[model samples]
Target: MTRTTALVIAVAMTFTAACGGGDDAAPETTAAPAASPTTAAAEPDDATDDAVTDDAVSDEGTNDDPANGATDEVAGDDPPTEEPAGDDSSTDDSPVADPEPADGFSWRAPADGEPILIGMVNTEGVPGLDFPEMRTDLDRAVAYLNDHGGLGGRPIVMEHCRAAGSPDSSQECAQSLTGKGVDMVLLGLDIFPGYTTFSAAGVPVFGALPILRSDYSADAQFVTGGNLTTMGVIAAIAVEHIGAQSVGIVSADNIGANTSETDLTNALTAAGIDYVSIKGGDNETDAGFQALIREAAAGDPDLLVSLYSDAGCIGAMRGRALLGIDTPAISTAICAGSDVLDVVGDDAAGWMFVGVGESDDSMASIEFEAMLDDGSGDGASGAGLGALAVTMIGTLARVANMLAADGVAVDGDAIAAVMASGDAPGSFPNGETIHCGVVAAFPSVCGFSLPVGYYTDDGDVATLPGFDSVSAIDYLP
Candidate 1:
């Protein structure tokens, strides 16, 4: 079974009470089921409230619906998840040559014998908007992946392409990665045309950005973080957890935020969760935030979800504060900058935004920290970096793992075979790693999402103000 199916089972067992209706012009955050009898039962409870303390990837254990592979179980329609863009239909499926351990697609000296090579690709130079420490952390993490025994004991030969924000550049980058004789395409950033080209060339790629355009095709070419469906699932979770009856959605028109908005709306509808929606409310500066505040407040949503970068996203935050709105905001990694939270100050106190790591998650934390200490293997590094860091490294690991599973000599067929076995169990560098097929289907994303961490107090920075995060539960799932 897929994650979606498992989520349905989970929901069937847990939240059937909330299945009725009522609309009282309630705040968006205070979702109501139209005053129906089912509304009272489906209402949020203290136990569920207690479960919201951390944001690391929880649901670590199994659910009754075990068909969705292992560990992808999520809550039902009361929510969901996004991916990428591309025409991946007509690609050449040629096998590539893995050269010696040094050049592109070359293998490394084995611990006990010969060498094997796995090809990886990265798109360099997309802007970073997450944390101050994330960019460098990502660079270091990739290097660390190389330093350790590459994938499956093979040294990874990587080709890096630069789109430089231009279509021509993106195409050039794609061609360059393809030309390097890679078994698979790895991504730093992605371009739709470039993505289609590579897919047409028969290269299976993985990316940090959710860019997969094909979801149902058995022969689709690329894999992304997820599809738009996952975003919907996440939104449902947010509405249910935040007790949100209304929500406002906005984006700054990047690959990240574009996918975020679509899925958010879908999730709301999936769970019958109502929302007041908007667009491009960058939450960066005071002015931008102020404008977003005007737009968001008109609908009287108790909750806000900003899907832009820091600069613009902060603007939305400022606008809300200036208007004296107490709506709790929920944002994605891109919009969840410390600056936005800082500017919001006391109002930012209870505001919740999603992050990839947890403050007190001991199990996954121990594994991630071990990789950091050991300098990280062909594993996902920077889990504790910013949200983007976790995402980027996770993507990298997915690509590397794909190459290894298909062996040094791989083609589109081999690569797809490895990826199509979505969520196949593996001891990945991250807490638990799973492969997602063709990026289109978004097999297990929702069932495996992280949570929101708070910043320090009203006066300081970060999600926690009164206690030192180093000593607190800094890794929670």
Candidate 2:
């Protein structure tokens, strides 16, 4: 799922509950229904209290019977009893190995020099939605960098601000950071980013992913592509990989979902393929999911694409299994998360997931594991979005080092230039070559390709053949 979709689901639910529909709204940040690899942003642009209403799902001449609530309630919808687990397996025997930090993605040792003050903004301490781990992970990475000889020997200092998941708080953060004279700003799950404030102050912004339209065209750029890029890749998979002549798409009926569905349909239209769209509420019961899936599969298309995440993932998988509908389905990486997989078990089979792939023993993966290690024998206690934080900071470090090596000032302007220079460089966490400005529609998105995978019979995600890192440029609108 993209940042906007994830934010919409969480924020929309909160507002709905505030408006006296508390029972219907999804609660807490536990396991977000659709928190994908790029999720961590705040509330969405058009997500209001009404966005979570039952009327959001159209009758569409399909649902005549009353909605009988599902017995197998999906996790992540209710208030979290314990801290939410990471996307990786919570099982005892995991596949990831905890190796020492590798040399490839490691930051260079710098001569001791002046400290480079960096500003970071994140959403935290909110009632229903809060993720302090986003900040904690970045702080850990900053400390590690400073310890390892700093940037060009210049120590890195962070000026952190916490947002309360509101535009006022977000703007306050931007305004507050500008006064601190920080070189640049890093955004971590800011719902309504104060981009104009930073732009006027000549402060360049870098974020984990695009959360709104302003994020794409503003002075900021993102490490990961958002919904547009993902939809493009889905289109590529539908037309080129699966050889799908026709497709059925199912998604929640909201601004974010509508936008993403439109994006996919546009690409499908351009590719000359037939498609039917089915929209429903963000949180649906088991029977509701079955109804939606039955309607979608009624056409017997070559493939099924789902834009649902979190509990919806469980519902979809269970609905398919119960109905015996085996048509290959494609969804965001969130649908493949361990939270959902642990619930669905073997029912997760036959679903292809985009945005995430298998956990390999590559140098990049090793470095990622090292960053999460707390010195205990166990792996990273904080993985999920914290991993995103590590990747973003590591990418910034790599860019800064590149500029310093070329005898240029390692400041905001130079860093921005290198990102928009149209040159591809090895990115951290995966070491995949990142090419920014590849998609004209989203110039700020640095990721042109993403790893695609499918679940095996054992309910584990594996890299699909010939789709380890498929580019979305060719299929994008």
The prediction achieving the highest lDDT against the true structure is 2
Model 1: per-residue Cα lDDT over 196-289, one tens digit each: 6767777765443333343223223222233242343245434444556767765565444554555567667665667766654223456655
Q: Write the per-residue lDDT of candidate 2 for residues 1-477, one digit (tens) a residue.
A: 111111111111111000000011122222211112101211223433332221111112121221211111110111112221232336678784322222333433433566777788877666444656666666655655555544444567677777766677778888888887888888877767788999899998987766666666666777766665667667788766778888988878877677777777987887778999998887899999999898998999888888776787788889888999878888776665566777898887778766654554444444445544444454442214555666677677767666665677777777778777755245555544566676676777776556565666544555555566666677777
lDDT of each: 0.36, 0.59
459 in model 1: Cα distance from truth in Å?
8.1
Q: lDDT for model 1, on a 0 to 1 scale?
A: 0.36
List residue ranges in candidate 2 displaced over 4 A. 1-111, 127-129, 149-152, 374-378, 381-383
Q: How far is each candidate from the true structure, as Cα RMSD in Å?
A: 17.8, 14.1
Determine the C-alpha RMSD for candidate 1 after optimal superposition of all C-alphas.
17.8
Candidate 2: C-alpha RMSD to true structure equals 14.1
